[model samples]
Target chain A: MYVQEPIAILDSGVGGLTVVKEVMRQLPREKIIYFGDTARAPYGPRPAEEVHRFTSEIVHYLIQYRPKMLVIACNTATAVALEDIRSCVSIPVVGVIHPGARAANGRTQTGIIGVIGTEGTIRSGAYEQALKQLSSSNEVISLACPRFVPLVEKGNFRSEETYETVRESLESLKQRQLDTLILGCTHYPFLADTISEVMGKGITLISSADETAREISTILYDRNRMASNNELPVHHFFCSGEPGMFKSIAQQWLGEQIDLTPVVWQVPNIV
Target chain B: MYVQEPIAILDSGVGGLTVVKEVMRQLPREKIIYFGDTARAPYGPRPAEEVHRFTSEIVHYLIQYRPKMLVIACNTATAVALEDIRSCVSIPVVGVIHPGARAANGRTQTGIIGVIGTEGTIRSGAYEQALKQLSSSNEVISLACPRFVPLVEKGNFRSEETYETVRESLESLKQRQLDTLILGCTHYPFLADTISEVMGKGITLISSADETAREISTILYDRNRMASNNELPVHHFFCSGEPGMFKSIAQQWLGEQIDLTPVVWQVPNIV
Candidate 1:
């Protein structure tokens, strides 16, 4: 188990950059290899079988990199593919669901939790299962905010339109007596500030991206695979669609936080 | 391999009940077996060799129950004995230091962290090593408060005396520009309210007990050993000291949180 092997991360679109930014910030020494299936921007409305197939293709492609770990940064893919990927891969495979659920379980005093995700993720009931698996008594309320993902993918973070959109989408969730809310979708972290403003100060928003980065650190340390690079390590990024929009969004989102090398493959969805 | 096997946790004294409360709250279905070395309390002042030996003895005794996981809830003991226990045991062995360090690394925006623990833990520099292992740029400030453990073991949580002692012990540390302060010792969580009052709200207190419990859930999930018992499992507790004080403190600290059966072993230190 070489420690210098980069951790591989894959997502359906630029939303996974939320996880990338967090991993870079929390674990500065570890190298990363990221893949964004920009040709397949939103996997939320897709069928489960198609999402699973797309996820498997990406994992097989990224396997060539010999990553020490594989992280399914997209909640939709994770809902359908995390266990399948883990069964096929030898390295540790982590998803965004459990970490966010674990954080919600740990943080919520009232045991009433709210989860917001894409339609595919909500339909999968993965968050409810993950939360209840830890403790049987957690009352889970789930919502699928399909509108929020488009705003994040377009990098439209904060404005009057965005605020109203966020507030309207979270209309019913905020009325519930929940002490903790899990941002089950990786894209949701980009809209956290506006979401928090709409939800008020009482509800704590648990970001799976941030928690997943922390878990990556935990699993790496547990397996004795943590990197010891004294100098800053360079990260690699790849995309399947137009690098122009991907790179523009990536640069605007990551900015100076990432020391990265972009490699646009222009690879379409695998048949 | 049975999912019902208890998780064994040990601390120098009643300080570990903080971890117990969290584990019970977070993963309530899992059974617990607790050991408190109250007779030889305050592993803080002891030599590293003695602390290591004491920890080994408790672990050896707990081995009879065949716990699925072993948690060194005491920071001083964890610093001196975690790797040794991990090497000797087949089950997963967790320490309080690294989880707290990881949480601090994930939470801090300023790259500055503060750690407060017993003399033994502070001298061992476990938190510093754990914190820097993830990110080298983190500036760590550590302080040892020997007076804090005795107060918690004696069931003194909040009072003018407790508040004054906590304030005085953290006098210098509260002045730093740290965005996060790790409760590096298990006993420190008992004094968290006082410590937070003294340190003010800006400096987030990263409780090792809380983070350690959360990590325990993560590792169990990762290993596919999470308990699935629908019934509320009865928990067992043992302390190598007088039953009166131990039971009283535990009862007061745990209150209604624990569903417990206490068994005072009255076993003195091994030769």
Candidate 2:
């Protein structure tokens, strides 16, 4: 089938906009359907079982749209729910961790890589496991920057409060003399300036957003499922939380105005 | 299903060893079953319909082993047969072009990229289309280096003859001032030293082998099909043609001993 179905992407909040920006850049001809579970914003502190349930709920809802593929743009959700969602859906599903690990592996000069993400993602050890799987000799250090996400959600990214929080949170990692660091959380890129400022120019930062988009393109092209050239692509955005905030952040990052709808979770269909 | 199946990879000739080397490095725990169509080597010069038929036949034969996924490690086969084979098989299939295009897109600073591959791959215009889809403004220059494959296949990569061939093939691209070049064929990386020398230090080379390996890692990890740690990986190699040269190249490139089995093609099963 020459499927022209929209590609679906989801995250815990606006953090996934990082990935959305890349998808727009890499696959401009393909339409996208994005959902941000901003109402329950931080999946980081939630239990793995609860996170899985919430993510599966979103996936089930997205299935109604008949998306060609699924992208778990949130790191915590990806760590907890990627496989569960993949099994539930026939279409291809992608997560951020492997792409992040691959990028860090390619970028690192000293064989020492550092990753910073939410408490749940860091504790999950997904990045560490992936990096180690790629190269056993790679020394991986993971830290949880619990405060970074809230700072981004509140649009306090460039504020003095955000800078101080980044400085204090990354104090330990700063001493590691690492050559590469992964912004493991999808939302972390918003605070990149502060993070880069504190880490110095020497430490290369790897964002899985770009890598994930490339993987998406690869899957689409190889399947001959890429969108036809005659039609224009339309993007749909939805958020479980306040639409205004999500719209503002998304527009700023994407450099285009987006119409966002506030969507409440409906009863998930039992499969 | 908790799939423990090995990933099956194929190429028209020993050229696909470049991809196999990267897969082994990136996913050390996953077993790989590889088939080299050495008897019908150089799918590049063959007609598209013939290449598709040959690739589908190899894929059908490999499917008997019940592989979890497939990787079309040859550029020509991917250009001609990836979609057809994907539809014929149930498992996920990956190809080299999109990954290579994505890499070149990411690496190019001048928005001008160059691609070198077999005549078939270059003539297919897949890289140009992909690059343009990523960015309509990107300037794409594609060249077919038909002689490079023969040089690698004969184990004459570093010889002066190979250097002169690269210098001559790349003369137009060198003058184009490209900041990035996609080594569009899998066989080309074996001759990377000579190609790089010809292209000069300004052009960054993108090897689809590494990118394809990363995509495989992403697909396997997302599907929860990653191998268990309890089992040690065993590599299996097959060649439709002479095994001696394939074995020599495989061992030298992978820096490990490989046992290559010679297999003659049986009548293909009609799907």
Candidate 3:
């Protein structure tokens, strides 16, 4: 019965919508204020400090709305900026890595797990460390599916090119005999069916989007900050790049008509 | 890498073992320091303020060890005291409700969900509110199986009386046509088989303990607070009440020999 404030969710591009979809599925009544820094496109290839700066800047834009929570929906951004953003705001903030790692631990019976993400997420070894911390006995295999985000951004999840790239990237993991594979990158869930096909039905694919949405639900409930059930929710969308393409893809994925507002970045001087 | 510090976990009674069991399974290298306030067992019926005080006192006691994080493993304690404890400490603090709600949200498809918990949890309407916030369209039915807790405390989860109590309490929920049920109380997972039998295979059950453990894994990973993998983890257990019963039940549930430490509660003066 608390006041309903919009939750601000940001990602480098469309990858975070996988998270937004899950959040909407899990928390329908709560309004969402989403910003996709599509102008920056892929944060994966960018330096950690650059990702942090972009994340911080987007967060500053989001703060104007006074959101109740902030979700760093992009995996690369999350790896570099999650803690920094938590320090930036008093409201609850969450990212994707921990959720994916936790779900992978739960699903794997073979004690063998695999993680696939961008170069940064894989290179950072965040998933490997998290999996190891959870159970040192777990055999964690990580591979950077660097081609994945771009494929998803293009909305080519099931294309033949995607299949070849996915199969080639995951070919190494199949040899490891992993029973569970984590789509460490948020965008990867959009590629789940193809990934599942390549890995086969025997291997469980863990989506950070699903787990992150659940984590958000948990924190909101713990803080006595759940939105009231009385009103209909209005969701706001923004992207720094071409609104037409972003809107088209978002509508295709969301299965609804949406108004995507364009946001121009005002780079703030950092001390 | 951060220095390996014990992760502090607290519950009203032995129920937290479910979470500890998970933490141990997921994070094998991390040491655990567990405290079951068996002397002040069953936080379900207590007032929020009183529960908060007791939780704060226990947290103060646990903080002496300089734990790397705090896990509020009990649902009642978590619902009332999680945020306060987070405010009281600098180490990352986590709780059970959001995790439970998130898991249930993920599991439920019919939009009709059921929550069974202590009177305090049900009366607080935390689960119902959380579910609704996730999706206002969700029809959430909550029931207080107050009798279920005492049965669990006595380790009578599979007995006929426990079945009868579970059946009687959940009979109303069955009539509501729910596709998923959340074992909102940490003690309730112990009653899972009986509860499942009563609800039948049609409804999936969500365990707060499992979800909470996953959340803990997520937080530790995000902070880079993961314990080193090379060292063997040493787990310590404590109780303010009778250690014998607590130890026996814990050993049976964990399927491992554990050393149970007894601590005398020095009631701190609270303003």
Candidate 4:
């Protein structure tokens, strides 16, 4: 409950760095402890039970830090594990799905919204359910872009190949006449530019990453647990696979803020 | 905590209808009980204690409705009475200020944000405090547009005089180079078109009324208290002065939604 306690965030792979970047920018004073199960890489094609267990394992690992809040930054994990983790946790637990859903519902002028996510996220229909829970009249068109996670996992962001892949993946969605599109996967923000280009200027892209970070601020402030630290906070990063690519993407995504503070790194075992 | 119970919303005047409209759009199933202190409109120039008293009186009048939650849909009243009301209420009480501030902080690329509200809200420094709480580096430029609320109460949303008044009032803020402008007052959303025209597309306007509705959805869903009523529930309206002006403004602001449901109206005595 201490204000100085970090907000723990967990994702299947480096894809969750999108949420990390937003948290760093939106809540600068609050320290963070993150876990990226990069050894498992993409959880998109995995079974629900396995994703749930992996999330729980990461939660158990991060709980040792005694974070003020838990952010389930991966949409796949959030679709299955948010309630399970919330039941066990004493502090507030936020998921990527609901925040993005709420933001999209609020911003969407036309109730005909489009959602793009990994196979796991879209199949789970988490975004649709979340959106419907807010407003019943929302007409949701959901598509599973299974190719997206691997592109981000390998750090392939914004290339001719990437653009073509993104363009083809979004081919069907472009014709839906949707005014708002929810990037249902946290990894999607890394490819936001390519997606934006494919979707064109008429559609607004709602990043679950940015919205989740904003929700973290709202929940923390509501609970009176916001950090009052005046200085820049040093954040801790943990990954299950090779640290090289993870560190590079982490640094590139986070930019100057991570440069200001030396990161504490750890590579936990795949449970 | 029955989900079917209404959400009690109170404001200094008709400005809160903006929030009512958003709530209807965002959380349609939930019933609403609104109170507008029209007899003592323009709380901006009043003392904090008097504003607090008027807010408490309306809250008391609305509390008899046995609502599930309370929404302080007035920036001036929220500045002076939010915590006071929260301490005395059993259900969740939401104020208008922080939601707008959070949205602005999350969306601002340059850390410089502008806020426009009633005199009481600006004088209370609630927006700056809320913004700074999320990110310490934010440079907040705030202005109290004392002229804005009266125009809204009188239902003067758009006109040449209104545009001229808005332009002249915002002349100083135009030079600040702010990337985000928070319509910190709930009433400002009524004049959002004029405000946007004056501020230009360079600055994004954050409407507290819309953000507050979004926040209400978030909190209710988080608490597992969302209303499941498939039918549009009827809403109740109360005012301290003549019902003619208040009802007309409410209908015009709420439009088709209020037309679908028969509203129960009351004019409560000023305490």
What's the DockQ for every one of the candidates? 0.85, 0.34, 0.45, 0.73
Task: For candidate 2, write residues B1-271 as lDDT tens digits.
Answer: 4557889999998888999988877677788999999888788888888888899888988999999999999999999888677777778898898788888876676888999999999888888977887678689989999988888888777877888898998888877877899999999999988888888888899998988887787667655677766456888999987789889888989999986788987753232
Quantify all predictions' global Cα lDDT against the true fold.
0.89, 0.85, 0.84, 0.86
Which pairs of residues collide in model 1? none
Off by over 4 Å in 4: A256-271, B256-271
**Rank order (by lDDT, best first):** 1, 4, 2, 3
Candidate 2 has an fnat equal to: 0.38
> How many angstroms is residue A189 displaced in model 4 relative to the true structure, after the best TM-score fit?
0.7
Name the weakest run of 10 consecutive residues (lDDT summed) in model 2 chain A.
A262-271
Better candidate number, 2 or 3, judged by TM-score: 2
Off by over 4 Å in 2: A46-66, A89-91, A105-111, A130-138, A159-164, A177-179, A200-203, A221-225, A263-271, B53-57, B60-64, B106-111, B130-138, B222-224, B240-242, B263-271
lDDT of 3 by residue, B142-239 (tens): 88888878887887878778788888888878887889888988898898888899889898899888788777766665466777758677799999
Candidates' interface RMSDs, in order? 0.7, 2.5, 2.8, 1.0
Highest DockQ against the true fold, candidate: 1
Question: Once all C-alphas are superposed, what RMSD does model 3 give against the true structure?
Answer: 5.0
lDDT by residue for model 3 (A201-220), tens? 88888899988887777667
CA lDDT of A246 in candidate 2? Answer: 85
Question: Can you rank all candidates by DockQ, best first?
Answer: 1, 4, 3, 2
Give lDDT tens digits, candidate 2, residues A114-223: 99999999999999988987677789999999999988888777988888899999999988978999999999888888899999999998887877887787767655
Query: Which pairs of residues collide in model 4?
Result: none
Q: What shift in Å separates residue B271 of candidate 4 from its native position after superposition?
A: 12
**Candidate 2 backbone collisions, by pair:** none
